[model samples]
Target: MTVVVNENRNKRARVASATHVAGCRMDLNVRDFAPMAADEPALAGGTDEGPSPLEYVTAGLAACQLVTVTKIADAMGLDYTGLRVDAEADVKFRAAQGAMSPIPRFSAARLVVRMRSPEPPERLARLEELVEERCPVSNLFLDAGIAPEVVWAIETTG
Candidate 1:
């Protein structure tokens, strides 16, 4: 969520996100744009109308990985026709609830990318390496010593 302010002459990119309570849900607005609702399940006390905060974090990481991979593939001229990314995070519930641990965030995260392409395996591997080095979301976890594991499943299709 980067926005370049061309009129400011500094050419700085900033992300503006705000959230407010909308009944039993939270409405998140980015740059005064589309609003997404974040809610917990009935078991968690709120209506199960939208994804939870942790789920949104996982989704953001997955989406960031996809974008990074796509950019790398495009730069390398890889002809990938199909792409799927699945991401999940393991959080310490006890820590979140102040029951234990040092942090309340994800302890670990994983990403599985399935790609359909005719590109060589070596090229795909290099692309993966680049994505690992460049993805901001992945780096956030990596810098924090979470060290997310990324698995690539490349399948050639006609």
Candidate 2:
């Protein structure tokens, strides 16, 4: 099948801003969307008002993968009934705290995609490949030397 290229893929600037609200807490705005907050757990000197910045990063990766998969599956004519994604990352607090450590802030990340589809495994595999290649957030992790391990669980009806 031939895939239609997006005409609006030209370069564009995206903007977001954050302001410190309190200890380890920040209020953020992105492109006129509803305001959001970020904060660390109480153990980290935060009131646990919202997810931490690291949590947002990990969640963004999962959400990006899900969106990329949906688009690629549509382009490939792959059928699916449901899709879910989970993401987690391992971070070295010492590095994030400005300690003298060789370890990167994020050491590793993993994404598990649970999909319910009737499509064949070969088709799904191709979709996975395209999603990994096209997902910007996943590429960010890879470029940072944190290779995210992506696992797909495709459930099919017998």
Candidate 3:
């Protein structure tokens, strides 16, 4: 019976793994962005300037975790008025204060997940466990040893 229970737990619906790909061409006074995988090669700086593909990756990690947590809460029937996640990076650098690279930054991250569920502390605790377990972004941060903090704040409106 214990074996069956464990197997069933492992059988829960889950999706893991994805392929990220993109390509860029730089040919202007200032480099412009192009689709990583475009049907036709796009001209650089012709389109409106926007975030580089790398920025998209960083945002993806944050947003993916946020959406994953929300989905888990819904699937578990946990009641919550709303939820939001804010993420920022406290990056490393090319060198120390005066090394060399001039990369301006390596990268570190800070994330805050603000949850607005009215469930008792215990229930919220369970949801936290689920998000921690299932959120790819959160797991990535944990596995990578990036410091992330999630907190609850009383909801309010004006």
Clash count for each candidate, listed in order shown: 0, 0, 4
lDDT tens digits by residue: candidate 1, 1-158: 13233587567665756475764588877776788888977876678778988788899999999998887788777899778899989987543345543444688999999889987778777888788888889998899889889998888766
Regions more than 4 Å wrong, model 3: 1-48, 96-100, 103-107, 154-158
- Which scores higher on lDDT, 1 or 2? 2
**Per TM-score, what order, best first?**
2, 1, 3
As for candidate 3, its clashing pairs are 22-36, 23-36, 91-108, 92-106
lDDT of 3 by residue, 43-140 (tens): 33223244444455467667976787777777777777667777665556454456543443425665667766667777667776766667676567
Residue pairs in collision within model 2: none
Tell me how far candidate 2 lies from the true structure as C-alpha RMSD in angstroms: 2.6
User: Residues 17-74, candidate 2, lDDT per residue (tens digit)?
Assistant: 9899988899989987998999989977799999989899999999999998888898
Give Cα-based local distance difference scores for all models: 0.81, 0.86, 0.56
TM-score comparison, 1 vs 3, better candidate: 1
Which of the numbered candidates is closest to the native, going by highest TM-score? 2
